[model samples]
Target chain A: METIAKQGARVQLQLNGRVREGFAEPRTQLCDFLRHELGATGVHVGCEHGVCGACTVQVDGKSVRSCLMLAVQAQDSRVDTVESLAEGELMSDLQLAFRRNHALQCGFCTAGILMSCAEFLGREPDPTESQVRDMLSGHLCRCTGYTGIVRAVLEVANERKSKNGEK
Target chain B: MKPASFDYVRPTRKAEVLELLSEYGQDARIIAGGQSLMAVLNMRMTQPKLLIDINRVEELHFIEERKNCLAVGAGVPQVELLSWPRISETVPLLALAMPWIGHFQTRNRGTVCGSVAHADPSAELPLCLKTLGGEVVLESRSGSRTVTAEAFFQGILTTDRRPDELLTEVRFPLCKPGTEYRFNEVAMRHGDFAIVSLAAVIGAGTIRLGIGGVADRPVTRDFEPGQDLSAALNETAWSLDAQDDVQATAAYRRQLVRDLGRRLIEEGH
Candidate 1:
């Protein structure tokens, strides 16, 4: 009876295109909620601390650390995760460029990097190398040497610009 | 690591927050932004019986332009502060230091008052506040009291903040004419905590410098606008007794003070 009473405040989250709800402690971590509770294991948790930036996810159009946020804080909010970058195995241009450029090695840090880069480069077509570096500074990869990662982003930028008749 | 289970408390009213803090006293620990506090709990460094979730307290999250200064509420996310163009233009140093506090991920979740309450020596906001001569307003069951930056800090990782008191907001002074400012920090990476961070402000024919991560607490140096660089270093370090730790040696930071102080003074000129 007490256990039944404990589950209060069902938060409405728009994950991908579907609406989902979860009743959790106000302190339940968003990452844990996404993984253990919701079975969306695509969102990897590399560092529980904020340093690694691995658990990044889109919280209402803003990239945020799922590890650092509470599930309840995102009540009645929309969320997008790595799994949403593709739909039924179709990938976005940035995702394909990452593949074509051999950007990822271990693949653990890819999703967060992809989400952040997708948002950043979508708004910026002709970003400088330093701007790319600065924007990507937060996401860390222990596998790739960062050369392929940066190059892959440049590849996407050139391809996207050429396709759009941009300089 | 999973945090030890504890009773959760979310108080909506300021008076309710004050009362909860008083009722729990030392056994109660506040969470805002949870940047540092969450890490503390995860590490088992602190296990407060009552976890006061101040993030739900609506009054704590604000960025209002007060009569004499900018009143930044405790719950104002660090990212929101950076995104505010007016804050960037009006409080340039604070703007400059925000990105350096943590990566975008951390800043998105970190809070202004959480930075002050944790009072890490290397943290950016403390030095920014110290350099700007900001004031912190503390609220408790009794009433409110303001502590100037210089007097607010007590020692390393410590403040004059009482156990029962909650820091409600931080007040940053309005910039004056000719107020050129510079914030510089060196880390292994750009966003990592600084080995030594300096916030230098020049205005009103005076020079104000705040040094962090070089001492037990932030140390400030005030000089006549045109004072010589070497003299400023000697007075600020030797007279003030800057402390050092594992990140970099004490002597190295002292030398950095001289080098950075010289550069900032010239830049401010």
Candidate 2:
């Protein structure tokens, strides 16, 4: 517990299928580190206290609030930011559904919501509207009223289910 | 808001964590999952000189069935515990209440022990522990000691844990036969902190009720099935000393205790 001098520590993590390296002070949050140091701006930072859910990202395949985690804690882990959701200009089905359903307006909360939906849909491929609404509870959108987001998520789920040939 | 400057250390072994705790006592804070602690840090509510990250301590990540209780370690995340294969059969009350703890994003990284250690009055895990008479294990360099949930939670955002002691695990007693449980809460939104939460355990001859978010700490009482149930619930509600806050009025909370208490009791029956 001896206090050391304040300084930046080296942090390396697999971000968006790439090994990214950066330096973070002990007090640096994962969101700030990803955006400021590692240049992953897709991980937004609305509330640094974990309530706004604008900083959601995947660490080891689980969606978490980047604001609530230290960058040093994510070392050696696999992280997925919203930048990884698409394949070189091609939007993922969920993103396309959001566009088709007009799910986003301000676009400030879109990245985090998409990250959360990606993880949720990966686990539950055929979620009901209520389930999707429950998942959206984690996120706060000043725009859209969450109706289109819910519709978009359910639409993607239905599309994925039929493509997988599951009833 | 950014956290104040501090030295961070990830201890790979439980012993290392214990040693750090022993050395720093009140100056060192253990960071497991960092769900609650991070928020406080960002707000500068606490400025510990050093943060001992225990996520790398592999020995502390486990959920074991020990005789009459389920022991959850400090490193076991809430999501993992919620998804445990035998959780519903082993601890049905927890199974019924886990989803109400937080949102899916937070639960993926928040630890069960972390929430108990944080000792938020409205949190589901602490209320569950108190209602089930669970035990909390506090470990330090010198030794380890176990405290019952009732004795562990001292007040709002407080606990009986010493500065040098680390909350290593919490043991929830296994559900007994012929006993039924029902948990419900009223919150502004799903995943928000409960305005008033209630847990009821109905046994063969007794009904135990635990109430949270209406007091400084979660409170519990036992009532005989043959007694005046409404009167007893009213007395218990009055004894909680509810206060007026932004989320709810003191009178409204008391009313919830009287009404929700009755409904939960009936549901259990």
Q: DockQ numbers for every candidate?
A: 0.35, 0.64
lDDT of each: 0.80, 0.92
Q: State, as a TM-score between 0 and 1, how close model 2 is to the true structure.
A: 0.98
Q: Which candidate tops lDDT? A: 2
Runs in model 1 deviating more than 4 A are A1-12, A23-27, A122-126, A158-165, B238-244
At residue B259, give the lDDT of candidate 1.
Answer: 80
Best model number under TM-score: 2
For each candidate, give its TM-score against the true structure.
Answer: 0.91, 0.98
What digit string (tens of lDDT, one per residue) describes model 1 on residues B1-269?
Answer: 55566666566767788888888888988887887877677667887777777776788889988778888998898988888879866788887778788776677778888898889988999888888989999999999999998898888779989989999999888777678888887777888778878888877777788888788778788888556768767667665465556666777777778887777778642
Model 2, B1-269: lDDT tens digits are 99999888888889889888889999988899888999999999999999999888999999999899999999999999999999999999999999998799999999999999999999999999999999999998889999999999999999999998989999999999999988999999999999999888898998899899989999899999889888989999899999998999999999999999998997552
Worst 10 residues of 1 chain B by lDDT: B237-246
B217 in model 1: Cα distance from truth in Å? 1.8
Candidate 2 residues lying further than 4 Å off, grouped into runs, are A1-5
The superposed Cα distance between candidate 1 and the true structure at residue B10, in angstroms, equals 3.5
